[model samples]
Target chain A: MKIRTLALATAAGVALATALPVAASAQDAIYVPLFTYRTGAFAGSGIPIANGMSDYLNMLNERDGGIGGVKLLIEECETGYDTKKGVECYEQVKGKNPVITSPYSTGITLQLIPKAAVDKIPMLSMAYGLSASADGNIFPWIFNPPATYWDGASVFIKHVADKEGGLDKLKGKKIGLIHLDAPFGKEPITLLEKLAKDYGFELKLYPVAAAEMQNQSALWLGVRRDRPDWIYLQGWGAMNPTAVKEAAKVNFPMEKLVGVWWAGGDDDARAGADQAKGYKSLSFHAAGAEFPVIKDIQKFVVEKGKSQVDKAKVGENLYNRGVYNSMLIAEAIRNAQKITGKKAVTGEDVRRGMESLEISEARLKELGMEGFAAPVKISCSDHNGHHKVYVASWDGQKWTKGSDWMEPMKDKVRPLLEEAAKDYADKNAGWPKRTEACDKAS
Target chain B: MDILYKIFIDPFMQMGAAPDLLVQALWEGLVGGVLYALIALGFVLIFKASGVFNFAQGIMMVFAALTLVGLYEWMARHGVPAPAAIALVLTIGVMYVLAVSIEKFVLRPLVNQPDIILFMATFGLTFVLVGLGELIFGGEPKQMITEQLWLPKGSIDMKILGGLVSLQKIDIAAAVIASAMVAGLAVFFQSTRIGRALRAVADDHQAALSVGISLNQIWVIVWFTAGIVALATGIMWGARSDVSFALEIIALKALPVLILGGFTSIPGAIVGGLIIGVGEKLGEFYWGPLLGGGIESWLAYFIALAFLLFRPQGLFGEKIIERI
Candidate 1:
């Protein structure tokens, strides 16, 4: 009789534990699930972004009560940047009626693409994902904004051409690509290969596997032998720092090597100490804590000791990236409330807001982020705005703006994006067609 | 004919053309091999005594490094004088405590168990150390205190053979330190009283226990020694790259070294490390492009696999002679 009573008590405890979260989520709030990673090998890159994303939303809740008088219930599910864990996080949070999800990893973003359409939740990959998802006709539920990997590649080639005087000077030049052998690193190859052919340059390819990221003697040895005139690095996490160090070891001119934006973390360049002075990387938004919005975050959230961020790390590149990501989420939520005439909106409502999202120069000024980033305008057909981006150079201590804004060659990019999107849809046997009306059309 | 020439003649011709690059590759490989041997030494120390594979050796290295860096950072924040030196001493203490605790809590209770069970326990220990290290140090990569430890920096660039070859001063320090540690350990194992006791325990755990040797004590000593070797490997590798959990992946590279050199032989580890390291670098440099590059990741394994087919008992491994 006692054993039975104990078993009944244990069952009741488990039930209560499971039931309490559902009751708490029933409050009148916008449920936004953030699939953020704060652990694992890539956590060095993931932690700052996690802190920036969460602190911004928390700041909004504390300062303004919430958007449109409804509180924002921001929940973070740690993915450790692992695709399997990311998918599991999606499964766990989908039932909470989340307005949107920001899958920080490209691998996780790919996994969530199919589920987002069926589940009616929008996924904001934010400058990193399947670049082909920029085509909204085939991928209505998925969105990549500011620019795609192809745009970054085009801008890099254009910068190289500019330095050499013109496109015609690129003939007979040898260009090398050192990239991680993952989907994220491989994203730029097709665009680069096309550019190589179009411009008559000899392309050298050097791929590094994820497992061999830290040990890169062979790759650098090859680099020393081939002696490419310019090297474009497409790497992430530990691969970035190791590549920087190896370049220094091989006596490669730091000025000649450039990294994709994902490789532009302060820690990555700092790994080479003084030797990384002239290393350059592409950037969509400005870095550092000088902006007004950052100061406000410091006053509202970080100073209150409710944040995990060290005070010194406030304006770092990845942290600012997180802040920009949250800005998109907040603006989309506000837009959703306005369009639906409701305070607490659903994921479908946010989908419409994202489809018709527009952040103009005037709006950026109003939001205290003037000159922080290029104005983004999302349309019904085009999700990524394909805006201009600039290069940021590491000066041993911090990053400084390296170049003026350069536009992506859309003439070469759009056709390829459309073809890849169509291919993706056709490959999936039961891929859904977009029947939902566009926000502008409605 | 083209394939044969590309395979056999082209690589040698390229080497002849750029003798400086060949010398640079050899130096890099030698440095890499020394680090690999240091990690394998940790494995051999524990496996020789306990007969457990001790899969946690890799994470142990990472954990040891994180602890050193974390303690130093904490002390520096607290305004402690000589923080690096003090932290180094404390980290050695912490490693000792860890060894004693592992021997007591993890190994002692499972005494006389099957070898596979003990091996699984080490796997569990790996997850525990990874979590504990992350919890204490946080998950960001940190700079190794190479300067504070008084290790050298910058490289010695020599202009020779019509080209320049740069050898990092830190890599040179690492090679010297590794050799000293190996020699020290060799003397300890051969000459000391505890070393003889350890050999006795390793020879026959039951017999040693019957002859009044304490199994628990010997296990503690062995683990503590392994911890020291792990700390050394971590510092060297961390200097090469930044100290992060990613360093754990490089630990698996030592496995091929173990297979190529006998698992039970100390000198074999060093020889095998150099062979695998130099072989992989040369292979990846000379012939990797024909196969599209990135072969260094698996070339070491292929070399080890070839060794397994010919000499099942590694280069210096004792030949098993069981009279059935």
Candidate 2:
């Protein structure tokens, strides 16, 4: 009986191993791995993004038969928003030879920065990684497109200045920054401090520990006592709603408070409900599913029940943000196909594609995303376009565009970005200089 | 002279100038303390009875809250009548089932295990509950059923010391409810047959068994009682923010309370919670600026460490006189 059982187990193991690879190799597809957190504290913010990223790529497969006739094999590895788990996920998924990696957390992105070049895999951090990575001339493998955190801060200061009639009026006015006490949250401090000195405004920082994200009564008490004229919040996940609620508790004017894009989820605003009305946050992409591309996603992915997203939330802000992210992926793949003249391209090919990537107004309209986001034009020297972003305000229920597209202060931001990039290389001994050539196509 | 003035004199001067802010901070601290005390109350109940450091208490709080919200949403979606009340009752029933299962599956087989073994088991239990809760509730933060439960909304602003101080109505309700629950638990422990049996078990396992008390029954009851406390803490805290796994981190704050208060004393939990909460708030409000403003996270632990150095057994922990 023991001999028979051992032979049966061996046979089953052999059969399983033989069947798995056949299924994996059945289609020649471009592998894309998303380091996502579907469980843990950050899941509230992460779920929609995961759903959005997966759904868009899946929709492409379903509706368009994948980008440029090659299927995109999208896979997700749960990280729970921990940097250690993120690295483990990267190691686990690296063996698959993925065309690109998108580790959504800034912490994860920072960890993968030194590894991406060694592994020859390009990382897309979207709008949330190291601001200095925007200078592709220094850091070639990492990409944080559209706008960097410093760009967001510059625009935020610009918005506050605009609200006060002019930048000259900002002198002596107190500006408080309520940020999560993490690298991502602190990314904007230097830029804001620079702008503060330039504008002659008083800058005060209120850092919230990650553990104490939900508890901010003392922080809000400080806000109440200091009575800063403007408050900028760089909070994420559970911190945003609690901050909004606590700000209301102290009778702080909701209109005077602004948040970064990460803090502007529907759930974040809805937590405060009517009390959060007039609360504003910055956004590069448009909200709502009125766009034609979103309609296609609904038609192909959500309606067919292939999506993990709530059917009602098909066109929400973060979901659309995901669509935009995947759009970048799809566009990069298409550009790579055009550049390398190969239906299937490697990560190096994708890097070159990203360098030369251009999303003109006409191209956006052609892709059924007209007016959805600013026109993006990436080149060899600049990975991030430093694109303009608008402020979206909560009107007791949903978000509405509250301001015109405001450009980031690139004139001031560029010099600082170069200096920081140079400083970053200086800090790390033997940091490899960018060896990749500037593509003339870019 | 400047450093000394900044440390001692500046904070007091600021407090004197903004007396209303001081009052506001005090009220906030008190409310926060009450909630922390409630969480510590769960730990004290289980520790006093089972002598196991139940590291799973925090996840249990998140699980209980998730169960309540998940059940309510399920009921409402299925068109159940009075979904909120029915869901609350069902959640209580679920907690009872959880208590029994934990006692049967986790504790029954390990009846004679070492305290360290049982503590490690709870560490394992924490992960089990986290995975289970995530599987069931899908890990998204849900808004508490505050409107459905008829919890008070909005705040009341009062003029005092020539300025306005705002107090949230829900916080007031939480304070009152916490006090009533603590009082009820006190009465139960001090004046009931089963509660006496529980105390007997807490005193000595063999002695209680010899006196016709069942350790198994006592554990189930104590765990169930702790479950109810967890539910209350979950609701009040969730109403303040939203129901999510993130609330699990706040439960770690109770560890310092347990350290400052005795592991076995109920009143110590409340007093310790108040001290930590109020102390951290005042520290953060007055002195946090000098330290760059995120001191509330570590201030409670620091306060507990100070107490550990001065009173090793805690404010109300029984003195352990071991014979060599």
Alpha-carbon RMSD, each predicted model: 1.7, 1.8
**Model 2, B250: alpha-carbon shift in Å?**
0.8
For candidate 1, lDDT tens digit of each residue in A349-428? 99898888999898898777898999888888898989898888999999889999999989889999999999999999
Across B1-324, the per-residue lDDT of candidate 2 in tens digits comes to 998999999999988998998998899899999899999999999999988888989988999999999999999999999999998999899999999999999999898789899999999889999999988888788999987888899888899888998889999999999999999998999899998888888888889999899899899999999999999999998998899999999999899999999899899999998998899999999999999999999999999999989899999999899999
Residue-wise lDDT of candidate 2 within A1-442, one digit each (tens)? 9999999999999999976753563348888888888888888898888888999899899988898999888889999998999999999878777888999999999999988888989889999989998889888888889999999999999999899999999999999999999998999999999999999999999999998999999999999888999999999889998999988888899999999999898989999978899999999988898999999989998889898888888888888888889999889888988998998788999998888899999999988899899899888889898999999999987889999999999998889998999898899888898899877553
Instruction: Please name the candidate that would achieve the greatest DockQ relative to the true structure.
Output: 2
Instruction: State the weakest 10-residue window (summed lDDT) of model 2 chain B.
Output: B146-155
Over 4 Å off, model 1: A2-6
Q: Write the per-residue lDDT of candidate 1 for residues B1-324, one digit (tens) a residue.
A: 998999999999999999999999999889888888998889888888888888999999999999999999999999999999998899889899999999999999998888899999999999999999988888989989999999999999999999888899999999999989888887888899988888788777889999999999999999999999999999999888788998998899999999999887788888898898898889889999988888888999999989989999998788999998
Best by lDDT: 2
**DockQ of all candidates, in order?**
0.76, 0.85
Candidate 1, position A215, lDDT: 91
Docking class of 2: high
